[model samples]
Target chain A: AQSVTQPDIHITVSEGASLELRCNYSYGATPYLFWYVQSPGQGLQLLLKYFSGDTLVQGIKGFEAEFKRSQSSFNLRKPSVHWSDAAEYFCAVGPLMDSSYKLIFGSGTRLLVRP
Target chain B: DAGVTQSPTHLIKTRGQQVTLRCSPKSGHDTVSWYQQALGQGPQFIFQYYEEEERQRGNFPDRFSGHQFPNYSSELNVNALLLGDSALYLCASSLWGQTSLDTQYFGPGTRLTVL
Candidate 1:
């Protein structure tokens, strides 16, 4: 079975500080990894995804993730955090061969940016 | 192009009642997948529909069913809903038939509450 783990349940950082959300996945083979963000009472927004090729994938909203297959990790990072960037973050894994993939997600990490 | 959209943004139902949520995939997307997101948790895969047929399913019970129309829109039907079934149901759209990989665009999601 495939699964994702986001060890951080909650993280608070000052505005303009660096941010990193760790994610680790368990899959038998190479898996499709993704990061998604959700604001309060809003639908989820895709931050970044890694299918293949580049280990470093850049996404919208000034976010980027590095996929380290050997470590079985795909951690999301941002150079500087903004107050509006506070939200819930999720890491997901899916099948590599299938286009209509079923996503397995982690428990999620809540980010709180402070002034 | 318009992004994926879900109807009945919020729904309230009693235990043992039945509810149906609808989703319209993004333009040019042929596959629709459903997910259940509990409060304070990440989303879990429910199933995926492509070409009006279910291509993949998660560990959900048979009480959860769905249908995809010829126009590529979809619906999620939950019968004999329990209080535990209360969650935000998300609909994601992706292009099928690709052996390699693709991104699944998500909708705003429908919030269901069971009393």
Candidate 2:
């Protein structure tokens, strides 16, 4: 079975400070990893994804993630944090079972940006 | 292009009642997948529909079912709903048959509350 783990349940960062959210995945084969953000009462938005190549992947909102195969980690990072960046972050591993390519997600990490 | 969209932003139902949530996939997307997100947890895969057929399913019971239309829109139906079934239902869209590696685009979820 495939699974994702986001060890941090909550993280508070001061505005303009660098941010990092750790994610670890368990998959039998090469994994399709993704990061999604969900604002309060809002739909989820894709932050970035890693399919193959370029362990370092950049996403919207000036976010980036590095996929370290050896560590089984795909951690999300931002050079500076903003108030609007506060949201729930989820890490997922996908395309596991059937052709529909279902995704398995982690519990989530809540980010709080202080002004 | 409009991203995926879900109907009935919020609903309140009693235990043993039935409810149906609808979703329209993003333009040009042929596959729709459903997920359940509890109040403080990550989303859990429910099932996926492609070409009007269920291509994959998660560990959910038969009480949860769905259908896809010729137009590529989908519906999630829950029968004899329990209080535990209360959660935000999310719909995701992706292009089927193009490449198995495509990312899923999510819609604003429908929140269901069971009393």
Candidate 2 error regions (>4 Å): A96-99, B99-101
Encode model 2's per-residue lDDT on A1-115: one tens digit a residue. 6789999999999999999999999999999888999999898898998878899999999999999999999999999999999999999998654345588999999999999
Candidate 1, B7: how far from true, in Å?
Answer: 1.1
Interface RMSD of each: 1.9, 2.0
The sequence of per-residue lDDT tens digits that candidate 1 reaches over residues B1-115 is 9999999999999999999999999999999999999988899989999999998998999999999999999999999999999999999998986635557789999999999
- lDDT of each candidate versus the true structure: 0.92, 0.93
lDDT of 1 at B63: 99
- Return the DockQ of model 1: 0.67
Summarize candidate 2's per-residue lDDT along B5-108 as a digit string, tens digits. Answer: 99999999999999999999999899999999999999999999999999999999999999999999999999999999999999999887644466678999
With a 3 Å backbone cut-off (N, CA, C), the pairs that clash in candidate 1 are: none
